[model samples]
Target chain A: MTTTNLPAAATREALGPTLVRLQQNGANIVVVDADLGKSTSARTFRDAFPERFFTFGVAEQNMISAAGGLATLGHTVIASTFAVFAEHAFDQLRMSVAQPKLNVKVVASHGGVSTGEDGASAQSVEDYALFSSLVNFTVCVPADVVEAEAMVAAAVATPGPWYIRTGRPKIPVIYTDGPRFQVGKADMLREGTDVTIVACGLLVERSLRAAEALEASGISARVLNMGTIRPLDVAALEAAAKDTGAIVVAEEHLTHSGLGAMCAQAIAATTQPVPMEFVGVQSRYGESATWDEVLEIMGLTADGVEAAARKVVARKR
Target chain B: MVYGAQSGHIGGSMSSTEILAVLYGRIMRHDPKRPGWVERDRFIMSKGHCTPVQYATLAESGYFPVDELSTFRKKGTRLQGHSVLGKPEGVENSAGALGMGLSFGLGIRLGMRLSNIDAHVYVLMGDGEQDEGQVWEAAMAASHHRVDRLVAIIDRNGIQNDDFTAATMRTEPLDEKYRAFGWEVRAGIDGHNLEAVEEALAWARDVRGKPALVIFDTVKGKGVSFMENNPNFHGAAPSAEQFARAMEELA
Candidate 1:
């Protein structure tokens, strides 16, 4: 295919836009990848700037470790792979690399069960939990294209190593072009007082639909797009618990060690703990089904999220 | 080779001697005095067990006095069997593990590329290190990112710590393996051919859009006749007579 030579201000995919920004900014950004270039959309970078890019065949651990060495010498190395292979670089990522607080960006595409038809082995069901446990690293799961672009830019500019979980599908652009995004702050899409729904990544759209469903039933549900999962929007979470007295956490990963666990543990710190319900894959593997089927199987649909919200609200009563 | 002084990883060191010689003599962009110079290229021995050759090269290159090479393996010397971080001079990463050099080179290459600096990263690995799954991961990664500024030299000595590489675990079709991974693989060159090694180094330095892997068909103990291609010398330092004979051949 011909190269995409879009206008300077034209809209583009998250990875493309972020790469362009890095080019313009003269940032010392490098994209290291496994053999899955077509999947991760890093071919554009290779075509545009051949020198600044590196492909490490399939060595995930060495890729991460090398990224660490590069970061030590003051380069911003962006290592990309499926979330599964990226997770395989755990020991280096946790102890030998990220613990030293290296300035490396691990861009894990095909996050969650979004790699539909590739089966459960390719699907990363525990990526969020795995990355969340790493101290001092920013954990981001942008919901849509706009949010993805913002998160990628923020991740590049953010200090320390950042784990950005992105999906394979072309998600709807939920937020506007300039949707006031930050590293730790939550975006309040719709406000209500009966129940608070905190979601991130692709599930943000589902959570918004769920909130609308609850609204049709005369229930006011506050929706917060918790794009940043690690330095979790704690103030917003506390407000949700205090105002609604009930909360529901939704993501596309495992229920345990995800946003649900964070909200539950955070809310418990308060005197009036809000009853929380988690909506995600309840500790199971996925098959190579379509995206819709996988979501249906894992109960990540709007109706499913709405059901969890209802359960949490009933517990409050 | 220095008798009791060659007490750690002598065979692999001897196998890699010629490659190390060519690098220090002509290929590597290093400054003996200013080891951390910004534009200077880096050499990370990820398969670090074979540091005696590196120490020998460092001594010859004037990074330190050749007389100091005798202190190797002695207590409190900076030159340990495996490379350490605090060693004075051009030593980059403190690598003790296998299959990590390519990754370290990846980082340095990325750094040099990002800053608009003209530099390269060269990493050396052993034939047996191919067993570590992480090596293939790094190989694929380097190809995907197209980090042409990095060069990997594999010392195909055909032996590991114990037995022959083929008898222990075969890594045949080495060049095609790396080529299938998308690297610009060049193999079957003699590691001792200073001219050939120089030409390969020049080509690797100029080639862009792909990392280069040069597989040197090296003997286990290259310079010494008795120990050449012998797996028993892989990690054992030569005795006094053996060292004398090896030095006599070098002379």
Candidate 2:
């Protein structure tokens, strides 16, 4: 089906309210929070659906465990908290929730260094790797507000445990009016043969800009919005490898075991392996920086991605 | 069912047996055949070290055949030492970790509440497990949510893994503590007495505004003479001769 086009203006800041609306429409849905409902833009759900909304009073483990119970009872449970504390529920997410394939959505707000001011301790730079290590977790990092809302709706409706990494800042709109947000499929922005940039979360826009820069330098660059990190789109990765010969994975997480590592492993498991560069935070803690500074320091800026793409192209066969 | 077997947590297990029997026998609305029935009530063995009792009760309740009790704790046997999730049937979550089952029960209960399913979630925790911080977390959340459909039964045999509960970590006035946390507390019943167990459960069933905690003050190894109130048997399976003696006493 040709994707229906939505005006970008309508999608720019639609994530928070849209999620609230979708959840309101679904009777079986409940939102659990760990004292950050307002920051995560879920305060409306708490206010409107007082009975359906549960506040766990800053206890992430209890919140997740309760969500697991709610899921078993057949409720679509959405547990929202900052990304760092959500990691505190990793054991519950793995043992109680994912192992049983319980239908619960762990909506982690303030994901990545974009959280700012709270510094490294609060930022979940390693969340993707942590959740992806589990078997039955669907890790999603939506780049823009529209995708975040769409992904939230999809996550609540989807089966099994979902780890949705959302941000605190209002990101620019990318997919306005429903631009084909398939769970395991990659959103190809620009087709190229020389190099491909695989990215998710806040890095998608930077990757797109990096592609434009590469084109100016006479390089044909491909940009793939890799939303689902756990079930890494191997088919798309393989197609990019066969078509592009060079690839760069950009994420707002540590380079070790996040989307880059999953892509690396998937390509290694396949017969065809492309020259790849992983653009993300190196193994280090976060610091107090503006989103721009954090992106630049963590090598997630457009220039950083462009440089990484150049290296990949240089290493290509 | 396996009366002659040497087993651990016989005291705590016997104390909780009637509670389990009531749940599996009547209180819990679950189907052994379709264990994952969405509308079915959930039961979590929070104090999971007492598997001999759970296996025996499960067998008696026809979750599996009575013959399966013979393979308890043996390697490759479905009857594991702690309750595992992927077992034959009647097991919900893998709950070897202390202070975890209650939280898991809370999750299932919350899920049920969200789905608008009128199913209750029951979790049986050991008196010793009260020391775990997560238990308090779960208790606080359960009470805060006023989960009327959630019931937590503590096996208050006053024994721990190493010694008496007082010697290890006292969790006395357990009823008061849970009440302070917002659970409607009930006590003064013989845990082994089927009639009292049914009565306390009926009370818990009637609760609407708060979670219920039934503290079963039972004797460790109630039926067996030599092992009665013995902390050594908290985790020690008896030898063949000891097992025979215990079985004789129980019979």
After superposition, the stretches of candidate 1 with alpha carbons farther than 4 Å from their true spots are: A1-12, A33-39, A44-75, A88-101, A133-136, A215-220, A265-274, B1-35, B48-91, B94-97, B110-120, B133-167, B172-251
Candidate 1 scores an iRMS of 3.0
The DockQ leader among the candidates is 2
Give the distance in Å from residue B16's predicted Cα in candidate 2 to where it truly belongs: 2.1
The per-prediction CA RMSD against the true structure, in angstroms, equals 7.6, 3.7
lDDT of 2 by residue, A1-317 (tens): 11124233322133347556876676467778889887777677767677778888878777777777667666777788888998998877876787778888888788898777778898888899888887888988887777877788788778788988888665556775555678999999889999989999888887888888888899999899999897888999999999998889999998987889889988888788878999998999889988667776777788999999999898974
Candidate 2, B190-237: lDDT as tens digits: 888888888998888778888988888888877887778898777776
> What stretches of model 2 exceed 4 Å from their correct place?
A1-16, A23-27, B1-11, B26-41, B71-80, B84-86, B107-119, B221-232
**lDDT of each residue in A104-191, candidate 1, tens digit only:** 8887888888778999999998988888888868898888767777888887887698998888876666765465678899999889
lDDT of the candidates, in the order given: 0.80, 0.80
State candidate 1's DockQ. Answer: 0.33
Model 2 scores a C-alpha lDDT of: 0.80
Deviation (Å) of B147 in candidate 1: 7.8
Fnat values, one per model, are 0.62, 0.73
Return the lDDT, model 2, position B122.
Answer: 86
Interface RMSD of each: 3.0, 1.9
